[model samples]
Every structure is written in C-alpha cells, then in structure tokens.
Target: MDDLTCDVAIIGAGTAGLAAERSARSNGATTLLIDETFGGTTCASVGCMPSKLLIAAADAAYGVRHAAVFGIGATATIDGAAVMRRVRNERDKFVAGVEDSIAKIPDAVKICARAKFTGATTLELSDGRTVHAKAVVIATGSAPMIPETFDAVKDRVLTNETIFDLATLPGSVGVIGAGPLGLELAQALVRLGVETMVFDKGNAVAALKDSHVADALHAILEKELPVVLGVETQVVPDGDGVRLSWSGESSGERHFEYLLVATGRPPRLEGLGLETTGLALDDHGTPTYTRETMQCGDAPVFLAGDADHDRPVLHEASSEGTIAGRNAASFPDVTAAERMVPFSIMFTEPNVAVIGVVPEDGAADVVVGTASYTDQGRAKVMACNAGLVRFYADAADGCLTGATMAGPGVEHSAHLIAWAIQSGWTATETLALPFYHPTFEEGLKPALLAICHAVHAKPPPFRDDGFLPGT
Candidate 1:
C-alpha cells in the first residue's frame, strides 16, 4: 500500500473542512482536507446555497404572478423551466467558485486521495495506499437522510439528495420533516405551484426559538405551504406515489402522493477510520466532543460539522472546522478549554435568528427588550405587519447577554445583537446606539426596552437551552 504523511489531515472538504484548512494556513501551519466531493454540500450541490437560489427564483415568479398584493394591478405568467435554468446556472457558478477557491491553497495544505484510517496514526486511501498525519480533523459533512422505512425505489420517492434533480414540479409533495430542509423545500415547491404539505413527527422545525416567534412563522407559511405540524409520518409503498401514514390526532391519519424525507443526518464515519481512534460515539451514532474545547480527548483527533454533533448547518460546521483546524495546527488545543463557542440559527421569512441566553438558561439574572415590525419607520411603505426583535440582559450588571429576532432585515440585527452580547453592553447603551428606522430592525427595540422596564422580572425557573446557552 502507498504511504503518505501530512502535518494535519481533514476528512471532509465541505464548508467546515475548507474553513479549517483556510484557518490553518493563516496560522502558518500545514494542513490537508479530504472528501468525496470538492464543495461538500452547500457550496456545490444540495445544501443551503442551491436551495435558497431555487427558493428565490420561485419567490420571484410568485411575485410576478401576484403583483396585486403590492398594490400594483398587473397579471403575469410564470415559466418554471426558465426560472429553473437560472437557478441551475447560478448554482453551478457557486459550486465552481468553491472548488476553484480550495484548489488555490498552497502546498502547506495537501489534500489526500480519499483515505480512511487503518491505524490510530495511519490511513488507507481508496486505491490501496496508506498515509499518516500528526493530527486528523473529521469535517465529513452529513448526507440527506433516507430512512429505511420509506420505499427505496429511485423514481417514485426521493430524499433531499434527489429532490433538487427533479425536472418538473410534482402535483403534490408531502415533505417528511418540518425542520429547515423539509420546510425550505416545501415552501419552494408551493411557491412554484406544487401542492406541498410539510409533515413532521413533532414540532422540531425552528423549534429552538420562542413559541411566539414560531407562531408568527406558522402563520406566514400557512399562507402557502400547508403544514402537517403535529403529524407522526411513516412512509410506505403506494404504487405510482408513496403512502405516508401519520397520526393527525383530530384529523386521524392522512396519505400523500410524493414523499421527501428531510428527517435528520447520520455521521459519515462508517467507511472512515473511527475504529482506529478512541473517540466517544453514542448509540445514535454521533461522535462526541469535549464540551469545553471540541477536542476528542487523548487522540490527536477532533470532530466538526454534522459528524461533530448533528446540528447540520453549513455556517456552524464551517466555524467548527476552522477552530478544529486552527487547534490542529498548533499541536493540540489546551488553551480553548476555557473559551466559549457560540451558536447561530437561520430561517426563511422573517428569519428566526437567536443568540445568547435567557436568565432561566444560566447565570443569576436576566433582561429582555423587543421591537416589532408594524411599528417600524418603514412598515407603512412596506405594508408589513410581521417580525420581532428581542434582547436579553444579565440582571446583575444590566449587560446584554443574548438576543433573538423574527422578521425582515433582522439579518443585520443578528450581528448587532451578537456584537452587543459579546461586547458586554448594557440595555441603556444598546438603546442609545444609532438604529436606523422603517425596517424590520425596529424589532430590536422591545427586548432592550423590556430590559429597562421589567427590572425585577427574572426569566423562567428552568433553562431548556437546546442549541446554545449563554454563560
């Protein structure tokens, strides 16, 4: 077998893997990244980039067909094929760009030829070769989940993997989950005139945010893609179309024509050399990381991306990968034992974004503020009545601790809140900061105001911080 070596080796070339490689290089360290596909998920194929691109196209077509909503009396027809072509072209350009970028990295970052571990410090390539590295980072991104319960016939059923390849919209689609993937695809399909139904076993889609914010999202999405919010769906063979069985409770059980499973992801550690390392993996089959610093304990191995903990998002994975790569370059991360990691979430339509924590989650005190969409300076011009911005403060010092938002233009507000929380600002200071008006950003007002108005009000007694906790 051929033998190889590198200072640091990364198992995936997705966003996280690439980020690690880039970060490692900047730190003047040698690194290597390996994956079956160059761009991994979002940048290349079926992750956020391509999905959002198609959704944007569908939204554009919808706007064209429904111009009356904007007070412009006009009639327009949609050409799905033309819009799809634009989406494909744009997606291709992005994937190509991602590949071209990673290729440009210097020799310090040597990409392996698809290697899996045969030993603790050694790996076997696809072509009967061997390699060794001082350290290894698992950035292997997740694949679209296709549970075995569903019929596996290629044409009749599809996973998130095959959905993007669809030539034309189906008459109806029963998406099998309510999370980001399912809802995103379901919404896009409906916008393109496909009768789409988003089915989920539970309310896991955008479930991490406040229930009030989720209600707002539900209302907006109900206007288009009908959500089977409280259903426990099971897939079976149904001749031309698949059959999905789910308890509708009051509605009993329901079936569907097409099925798209966007349930969750399994780590890509099977063929790779996890057996060679002594890392911790659960029965659910996820690699565990040291909570303090993301290290895999004694071994020179670290886990990032979906393989790290199944929170499958491009941005989070990439951020983790960069950290892993940086730590790998510096031998091992002994310093990060005290550093805290941040969490980020993204969504469609008034995008549900949250950062920091409520008093219930941690610490002794809490502060909150809010700004609503209807009262924004530009709400009149936009004719919008949706969106809320919330901020949390530590009761002891009145310092900003966390923030969350739902509405248009909250993208900028997420950054503002993140900075305020990380910078240790107080409610009074944040309120005094210059905030532009007539935008969804107006939502940030209420949470900060709450911090000031509600002095002794502590957060709930319990802290159920799922994804991120502000300490």
Candidate 2:
C-alpha cells in the first residue's frame, strides 16, 4: 500500500478545502488535498449558482406575464425544456471555471480518493493508500437530509442536489420545507408554469429570526405560491406521483408529480470513520471545534465549512477554511483570527436578507426602525411595492447593530447595512450619507430617520443639506 506524509492534509476538496490548501501552502507548509470527486463545489455544482439561474429564468417569465401592470400587453409562454437547457448549460460553465482552478493545483498535492480517519492525524484512502499528516482539516461539506418516512416515495422525491438534473419542469411539485431553499425553488417553479405548493411544520420562511420580517416574506411568497406553514405534513407514493397530506392548523391533501425536500443538509460525516479520530463529537457526528481558530479541542485537527456547520454560506466557508488551514500549518502554536459579521441573503423575489445581530424581540436598550414598501416612492414607481424592512440599533448610542428586510433590491441594501454595522456607524451617521431620489436605496432614509428620532438624535429641521446633524 502507498503511504504519503505532509505537514497538512485536507479532506474534501470543496470550497473550504481548496481555500485551506492555498492558505496552508502560503504558510510554507507542505499540503495535500483529497476528494472523491475533484473540480466541484456545492455552490457551483448544485447549490447557489444553479438555483440562481433557475430564479433568473423564473423572474424573466414573471416579468413578461406581469408586463400589463406597466401598461404593456405581453404574453409569456414558457418552454420548460428551454429553461432547463439554459440552467444546465450556464451551470456547466460555472462548474468548468471551478474545475479550471482545480487543474492549476500541483498534481502531486491532489488525491482523487475518499478519506476515512484511522487516527487523529492519519487517514486511510479508498484507493488502498495511507496518509499521515502533522495536522488535518475536515472540510467534507454536506448533503441533503431525507427522512426515512419519505423512503417509500424516494423515486419520486427530489432534493436540490438532484432537481437540477431534470430535463424539463415537472407538471407539479409538492415542496416540503418553507426555509429559503424550499421557498426559492417553489417560487421559481411556480413562476416557470409549474404548479407548486410549500409545506412546513413551523411558522417561518427563509429562516428569518425576526417574526416581522419572516411574516412579511411569508405573506409575499404566499401571493406567488401556496406556502402552507404550521402544519404536520406527510408524504406517500401515489401511482406515478406522490401524495401529501397535512394536519394541524390547516388540513389538506394534494398530489403532485414530484416531491421536493428542502429540509436541511447535515455534514457528510457518516462514512468518514470519525469514530476512530478520538475527538469529542457532537450528536451530529461533528467534532467540537473552536470557531475563531477552527481547532478541534486541543488536538492538531480542525473543522471548517459545512462540516463545522458554523455558517454554511460560501464566503463563510472560505473564511473558515483559511482559518483552519493557517492554524493547521502553525499547529502546536495556533492563533485565533477575527471572523466577519454574520450576513445571509435569500435570492427570492424581493430578496430576504438578515445581517449582523438580530436583537431579541422587546429587548431592553434596543430600538427598531421600520419601512414598508407599500408606499415607498421608488417601489410605487416600479410597481414592486410589496414587503417590509426593519433596522435595529442600540438605543443608547444609535449604533447600527442588525437589519432584517424583505423588499425590492434588498440584496444590495443588505450589503450596505452590513458594511455600516461592521464599520461601527450609528444610525445618524448612516443617514448623513447621500441617498439619490427614485431609487430603492432611498427607501432606507425613512428607517434611518426613525432610528434617529427613537434615540432622541433627530436631525435639525430646515437644513439645506440633506445630511443629518451629527459629527
């Protein structure tokens, strides 16, 4: 059997793994990257990019169908085959770009094999090889979690991982789960002329912690598709399709050509022989690791990306990978690094975004400023007047702490808020920034003004300049 040794060995060559390799090598540590399949990331392969492609297609169809609102009469005829073709074709180009990056890595440092932990610092490969490293990083990523109850209808069930493979849209789809993934796909499918319904046991959408924001998003999505929440849902096979029955707050039975499950994705740790690692693992089979340093307990082992389950987004994975890799390279003297502020965006129409710290409801010393798009100037002009946004700040200092919103162009607005929070800007300071007229960003002015008022820092009246009275 072949044996290899390296200063750092990383398992799973996904986003986090690749970043780890780059970081480790930059630290002057000999590194090796191993994966069963190379040149693919969850985002490029199935998660983010492809889903956005489908959403883009859906948006086109929706715009065409709703052109009457602009006094333009138009008909939208969706060709499901053509839509799928572009999604797959564009998705391939993205995957190829990632593969090209992988190709640039040195051949001697890349291994195409599944790795299982034989010890804290040793791995046995699927290709009958052994790897011993001074330090190890687990970036194995995650896979969809399918309930055993749905096993009976497995043939007709689809998850994000497999849904993109469809040659044409299904006649109808029953989506189980009302989180971001489910709602995003459900809206896209419905817009693309497929009858789609979403079911969730919880009364939430897009995983928004702020009930106000969640409710607004839920209502907006319901206008597009039947999003049934706060119900117990069951699925069973029905001829060539699947049948879904729900009980509790709402009771109903429906049959669709396929079932789409967006429940959640647990880390792919089942076959990695984690039991042999001698690390303290949680019930989810994930090793306990320090977030700042990505170190697992006191050992020279690290966990990053979806494997750590800290933050599953691509940027967070890249950051955590860099942390894990740097710490792994400097093992026995690892140092912690500062992490970025939390930020997440869902690509649903009137995009949903949650940034920084979401203050608890009615928390002391917390003030909230809200804006509704129903009457916002730009939204009214665009006929996209639907959804709401709320900003939270410390009442004592008016420091922008967090924001939750479901509104037109929120994907862009959320970034501005995140940057402001990270820069330690107060509501009044942010309000001093220029806001052009007839733009979605102008919608933020009212919310900032409200925060200034709430904190007794309202701008002086009759100021010729639009800037708020502040330092």
Best by lDDT: 2
- Tell me the tens digit of each residue's lDDT in model 2 across 1-471: 779999999998999999999999999999999999895999998999999999999999999999999999999999999999999999999999999999999999999999999999999999999999999999999999999989999999999999999999999999988988998899999999999999988988877889998988888888888988899878888998998999988999989999999999999888888888889998777899888999999999999999987789999999999999999999988998988888989889889888888988999989999988877777888888888999999999889999998999999988999999999999888877766777888777778888888998855353122533210
Location of the lowest summed lDDT over 10 successive residues in candidate 1 = 462-471
For 106-164, candidate 1 gives per-residue lDDT tens digits of 65455556778776557777767666888777777766667667745435666766766
TM-score of decoy 2: 0.97
Q: How far is candidate 2 from the true structure (C-alpha RMSD, Å)?
A: 2.7
Provide backbone clash counts, one per model: 14, 0
What's the lDDT for residue 45 in model 1?
71
Best by TM-score: 2
- Which segments of candidate 1 are over 4 A away from where they belong? 25-30, 39-41, 106-112, 152-154, 252-257, 291-293, 337-345, 358-364, 374-377, 456-471
